[model samples]
Target: MDILQELRYRGLIHQLTDEEGLTKKLSEEPVVLYAGFDPTADSLHIGHLLPILCLKRFQMAGHLPVALVGGGTGLIGDPSGRSTERSLNTSDVVEEWTDKLRGQLSQFLDFESTVNPARMANNYSWLGELNVITFLRDIGKNFSVNYMLAKDSVDSRLSNGISFTEFSYMILQAYDFFRMNSDINCSLQVGGSDQWGNITAGLELIGKSTGNKAFGLTMPLVIKSDGTKFGKTAGGAVWLDAEKTSPYQFYQFWINTDDNDVVTFLKYFTFLTREQIAELEEQVKLSPEKREAQRVLARVMTELVHGEDAALSAIKISEVLFSGNVETLSGREIEEAFKDVPSTELSGNEEIGLVDLLIAVKAAPSKRQARQDIESGAVSLNGIKVSDVEKVLQSSDRMEGRYIVIRRGKRNYYLAKFV
Candidate 1:
């Protein structure tokens, strides 16, 4: 199937300009396509996954994928989806973020491909050197004030405020396309639905400045069935950086996908065949309790973003936690599993009674309650029921020589770390 048809089947195509022209261009030759990522944060979150994966999809289909890092335009934020203007970051901060973005992007594309290696470009290479005169006369002249104000990005911001710096972002982005076309022979730009205006502006500039045909495509913004935004949890945005969001948490984010949304996400994110997705859809309908679809989604997404080892670890952690088999976890796995669970630190590895340890970790309300819970078999130490109020916990009870897991009832868990 053609790349466009594949994306259409996956529900990835949101807005496309000159579909026939782009279809012909892609079919005729290995058309070079580019997508830009602004360094707004040091890490790209799950929200950025669609476009990054889109670039990979094109590359796998024998097209040259150019990942553009917007070090230049990031200095002046794009007013596409925001109601308020962005606070400008220092040049040092933007440069630092740009480097991080570049590194994260590199992991997604096969730059070492002998057939068609991916290319990485930064707009700062050209935009930083542009002078006010050249920017205004050469690029800014192409855009009319009336036409600019009519854009959704500008019109939405006009009520409260919109700075010239951000208003002129469309021109800078258009120049990026013009430059990419002139230098790298890039013919297409892809971005999120909110970037429709800027993308079309780039196409217009390329048409007028170079008198060449260029194409723009946008992907739909992800939304959850619950009507809340996707990629956001109670903690915050699910970051692609493992350090910011651990592999386990990232895996859990997909594992807990709403029943109404899982099948669609499988189609959108994974490279699963239509037949495979249809099978999963059938599973969803027949046995929603099995959650096979959610599990597959979590595994595929975790492996794609964090690598096989991390994904395996995440799966192991999830399984252990689900089965309440805390004792089976390794030291590192225990830490990853209980990272967010309520925890207390022990100053030293001291032998203490189970009830005393429970009191120390606040797993129980008090020593009296701890003893009562222990006697009632309502408390467990490291996945083993502790019924003896006098049962003592020794150093041998510690998993990994440092950590112990305590449970109050079936659900409440506490982590005790010995120094």
Candidate 2:
């Protein structure tokens, strides 16, 4: 399939301006395209997956993909998909967050190609220095207040009283596109459907000022079958950062996908070919109880984000904890597996007994509850059953002289840190 055809087949194309023209251009030659991410947080959550993956597809197709960091526009939050005005982050904090997001984004897209290599850009370098007077005379003249208010982003927030800072965000973002079109000959912009207004604004602004007809395309906002937003767990956004969400937790998220959702997610998240995904879908129909599709989706996605070794460790750790095979795992593997679970620090110098540690870590409600858990064999340490109510802790039992992994039943996990 051609580029647009392939994207459409995967259900990646939500909206496109002049699909035929853009498709012809894409098929003819390598087109420079871009997608922007606002540095609202230190690490991107799983919600940012589509655009980044789309960027990878473009790069793999032998086109230049520019990953634009919204260092300037982030100062004014995009009000398109929100109910309230955002609390403005300090410039210093935004700068630090932008650097963090830039680092995280780099891992997914290939940046080391000799031909049509991926490019990194920050709007701050250009938008930061453009003087107000000159900017108004040159760029602002093209965008009227009425035209700006016509945008959904500005219209939605009218009752909420959006600040001029946010109201002007579209214009500034448009300027970024105009600059890229001039400097890099970027002709296409891709973003999520929520960004349709801003993407089209950029396309319009570039065409008017530079007289170049740029194109805009967007992917659907990922939604669940129940109409909930994607990338959410009861715990919160499914983050890419290991610290925010454990690798084990991440693995389990996809593993437990609703069988109906698994088929679609594989196409959306994985690099699996259509034939391969088709096979998985048929496999799912043959044995829905087997959970084969979820297993594949979970493994491939985990490997993409955390690496092969980490994926293996996550699965092994899950088996040890869930299958009641704790005795099969070493203390080191247990610690590595539970690093991101909720944790507490115990008094290191003091000789803290098992019951005290359980209560201290809040694994059990109280001393009495801790003893019952141990007696019933509902508690395990380093994958070994701890039936003794008064077992003494030892340094050798602690991995790397700092922590112990505690499992309460199949799912609850905690870390006892002795600092």
Candidate 3:
């Protein structure tokens, strides 16, 4: 299938300018397309998956893809989706985030290929050197106040208020396309649905400046069936950076996909063929209890973002926790698995009885409840059911010589650390 057909099947095409013309252009020769990512944070989150994967899709179709880091535009945040104006970050901070984002973008596209290799560009390279007089005369003259005011991005922020710095973001992004066209002969720009206005603005700039037709395409903004935004949990956004969100947590996020959303997400996130997805869909309908679709989705996403090794480790940790076999988990796996569980620290190799440890870890309300839990076989230490309330836990019992995993009933877990 052609790139457009593939994108349409995946539901990745939300808005497109000149669909026929773009199809013709892409068919003629390898067209160079670009997408911009603003450094709003030090790391891109799961929300960025669609666009980055879109770039990969284009590259796989023998087209040259340019990943544009919005170093210049990031200094003035895009007002596309925000109700209020954004606070500007320091230049140093934005620069640092830009570098990090660039690195993350690199992982998805092949820059080492001999043919149609991916390219990277920073708007700051040109935008920073642009003088105010030239910007106003050459670029700013193309956008009239009325035209800029009518855009959804600018119109939505009119009541809440938007600064001149942010108001001029469209012009900066337009300049990015214009510059890319001039330098690399880029003819297409892709982004999220929220960026439709900015993408079209860049197309206009290219047409008016160089008398060339540039195309724009946007992917739909991900939304869940529950009406909540995608990639968000109680803690916060699921980040691509392992430091911000661990591989295990990231895998679990996908594994817990809602039944109504799993099939749709598989198309959007995974590179699996249509046949493969159809089989998974059939599995979902036949046996929803198995959660086969959710598991496949989680494995594909985890391996794509993190490496295969990390994905395997995440799966192992998940299985160990699910089976209540914490004793087999390594120290690092224990930490990753129980990072958010109730935990306490003990000094040195201080030994304690099972009942006292449960009380200290607050797994039980009091010593009486603790002993009752231990006596009834409702409490376990390192996966072993402790019926004896007097069972002593020492340094030797610590997993990896640091952690003691305590389980109450079937699922409640607590951790104690020996420091």
The candidate that achieves the highest TM-score relative to the unseen native structure: 3
Worst window of 10 by summed lDDT in candidate 1: 347-356
The total number of steric clashes, by the backbone 3 Å criterion, in model 2 comes to 0
Stretches > 4 Å off in candidate 2? 327-336, 339-342, 349-357, 363-373, 388-393, 396-404, 407-414
* RMSD of candidate 1 to true structure, Å: 1.3
* Superposition error at 122 for model 2 (Å): 1.1
Q: Give per-residue CA lDDT, model 3, range 3-80, as digits (tens).
A: 999999999999999899999999999999999999999999999989899999999999999999999999989999
Instruction: Give the C-alpha miss distance for residue 253 in model 1, angstroms.
Output: 0.6
Give the C-alpha miss distance for residue 404 in model 3, angstroms. 0.5
Tell me the whole-model lDDT of each prediction, alpha carbons only: 0.92, 0.86, 0.92
lDDT of 2 by residue, 121-160 (tens): 9999899999899778988888889888988888888987
Q: What is the TM-score of each candidate against the true structure?
A: 0.97, 0.91, 0.98
Error of 2 at 378 (Å): 3.7
**Candidate 1 clashes between residue pairs 3 or more apart in a chain or in different chains:** none
Let me know the TM-score candidate 1 reaches against the reference structure: 0.97
